[model samples]
Target: MNSTVTMIVRLLLAIILLVFGANKFFNFIPMEAPPEGSFMDALIKTGYMMPLIAVSEIIPGFLLLINKWKGLALVWLAPISINIVLFHIAFDISTIAPAALVFTLNTFLIYINWKKFRTLF
Candidate 1:
C-alpha cells in the first residue's frame, strides 16, 4: 500500500476506535437504544461488558494512534471488529456502516502488516 494511504487509514481507524471506545466509558456520545431483548441490550444489562469492550477498543486504538506495536494492535482489533460487523449485520443493518468501516480498516491494516504476523501461522 502507498505510505500516504496507509497513514491516512491508520489515523482514521485510530480516531474512530478511540472516540467510540471512550464514548463507551464517558457517555460523551449519545447512543440509540438497543433493540429490545437484543444481544446489545444483554451486553448493556451485564454492566461490565460495555466497559470491558471499551478497554479492549481503547488499548489497541491507542497503540495504533501512537504507531506502536501496530501489528499487535491490528491483531487485537480483528476479533472486536468482526463481532462489531456481525452484531450490526444481525440486529441492525441500518447501523452497519461504522462496524463495516472498523472491520475493513482492521483488515487492510493487517494486510499491510502481514509480514509481522507471518510467524504466527
Candidate 2:
C-alpha cells in the first residue's frame, strides 16, 4: 500500500479501536450484546473481561496512532481481532461485518509491517 493509504487505514482502525474501547466504559456508543448462551455470552459474564478488552484496544490503538511500535501493536491486537471475528462468526452471524472488517484491517496491517517482524521468526 502507498504510504498515504496505509496511514489512512491505520488511522481508521485506530479511531475505531479507541472509540469502541472507551465506549465500553462510557457507553457513548450503544453496543449490542450477543444472545444468551453463546460463546461471547460467557466472555461477557466475566465482568473484568470488558475492562481488559478496553485496555487492549486503547493501548494498541494509541500505539498505531502515534506510529510507535506498530508491529507490536498489531501483534497485541491480532488475538483480540481473531477472537472478535470468531465470536461473531460462531455466535452472531447477523453482525459479523464489523468484526470481519476489524480482522481484515488487522491482517492488512500485520502484512504491511511484516519486515519489522522478520526477526521474530
Number of the predicted model whose lDDT against the real structure is largest = 1
Kindly provide the TM-score of model 1 when superposed on the true structure, using C-alpha atoms.
0.94
Model 1, 17-100: lDDT tens digits are 999999998899888888889888999999999999999999999999999999889989999999999988887899899999
Cα lDDT, model 2, residue 19: 91
The per-residue C-alpha lDDT of model 1 at residue 68 equals 96
Per-residue CA lDDT of model 2 for 1-121, tens digit only, reads 7999899999989998999899988998876776898766777798899889999999999999999989889999999999998877786779888888889999998888888888878
What is the TM-score (0 to 1) of candidate 2? Answer: 0.89
For TM-score, the strongest prediction is 1
